[model samples]
Target: MKQLIIILFLVVIGCRNETKSDEEIDETVYDMWGDFTQVHPEFKKDELPESWYFHDNKEDANRLADLVMKGKKKASSGLYLWYKEANADLPKAGTKSIITNFDGTAQAIIKITKVDTIPFNQISKEYAAMDMGTNIEPLKKWKKAHWDFFANTMKQGGNEPTEKILVVCERFETIWPKKQ
Candidate 1:
C-alpha cells in the first residue's frame, strides 16, 4: 500500500512539473469580439476566431463573399503597400479568416491554403481568374483595373507606384457558413 501511494504521488508530481510555460500558454490566448453574439446569435464567447476582411465595395465584396462561401473562388490579391500602411498582419496557410460585407456583416469563414508576394506585372492569369470569381476575365482588363486602383491608393498614401509594384496573393478555402 505504501509503495503504491509513493508511486501515485510521484506520478502526480511529474505531471504537475510538465505544466506549460508562459509563452506556450500565451499562444493559446486570443482576443474575441465581445459583442459578437449580438451580430451572430450562435457565436460562443470562448471561441477564438480568425481575422476578418471587408475586401471591397458593396457589389464586388458581396460577389467575392458569395464566391468564397460557394467555393467558387480560391484566391485574392492586394497591394502590399496598402497592407503595410495599415499594419495588417499577413495571412498564412491553415489560418482561418472571415469575410465581411460593406456594412460589416459577417459572410463566411475561409481557411488560407496558400500565400505569396508577387509583382503586379508578374501576376498569373490563374490568380486574376480566381480574383474575378466569375467567368475568366482577360488579363488585360484585370491589369488595367488593378493598376488604376493601386496607383490611386498609393497616391492617397503619399506614395507612387513604380513600374512594378508588389502584391500579396493568397489562396483560400471556404471553411464555414456553408450553403445549405
Candidate 2:
C-alpha cells in the first residue's frame, strides 16, 4: 500500500509538471481566440495566417486595426531593446503578419516590405505620421505621445524608456482584406 501510494503521487506530480513546446501551447490555448481565418473574412488562399495586435488594450488595438483596414496607417515602430532581451528575431521583409482587433478578432494582414532601426527622436515626420493611429497630428504630437507610451510600457515591464532606445520601424503593405 505504501509503494502504491508513492507511485500514484509520482504520477500525479509528473502530470502536473508536464511542459509543452511553444507551438503546442500556442495552438491549444489560442484556439479560444477563434480560427484566425474566421476573424479575417477576406483571407486569400495563398496568404499565411498569423495574428498580432497594435496594443495591449482593446480600444487602441481596435482603433489602429480600423485604420489599417482603411489604409490610413501604413507603417509602425517598436522598441527593439525589449525584443533583444526576448531573443526575438526581426520580422523578415516580405513575410506577413495578421493584425487583430483588441478583442482578438483577426482583421487584416500586412506584408512587411521594409524594416530598419533608428533612435526614437530621429524618426522622420513622414514615418511618424504614417505610424500614428490617432487623429492627433504627428507633426505636433508624435514625440510627446510616443515617449509617454514607450516610457510607461517599458516602466510597467520594469525598464525605463530612453531616446537612445533603437526603434524598429517597419513599412508594410496591406495584403489581406485589400481596401474595399
Give a tens-digit lDDT track for model 1, residues 1-180. 444433322222101112234443322122223333345566664355533343435676666667777777777666665555545566578766556544445566666789888988898877777765655564666688667766765665557787588887878777565324
Q: Provide the lDDT at 47 for model 2.
A: 40
Q: Where does model 2 exceed 4 Å of error?
A: 1-47, 133-136, 178-180
Give me candidate 1's TM-score against the actual structure. Answer: 0.65
- RMSD in order of candidates: 17.7, 12.0
Residues 138-162, candidate 2: write the lDDT tens digits. Answer: 7456677667766765665567777
In model 1, the Cα lDDT at residue 45 comes to: 46
User: Model 1, stretches more than 4 Å misplaced?
Assistant: 1-47, 50-53, 85-88
Clashing pairs in 1: none
| Model 1: ten consecutive residues of lowest lDDT | 10-19
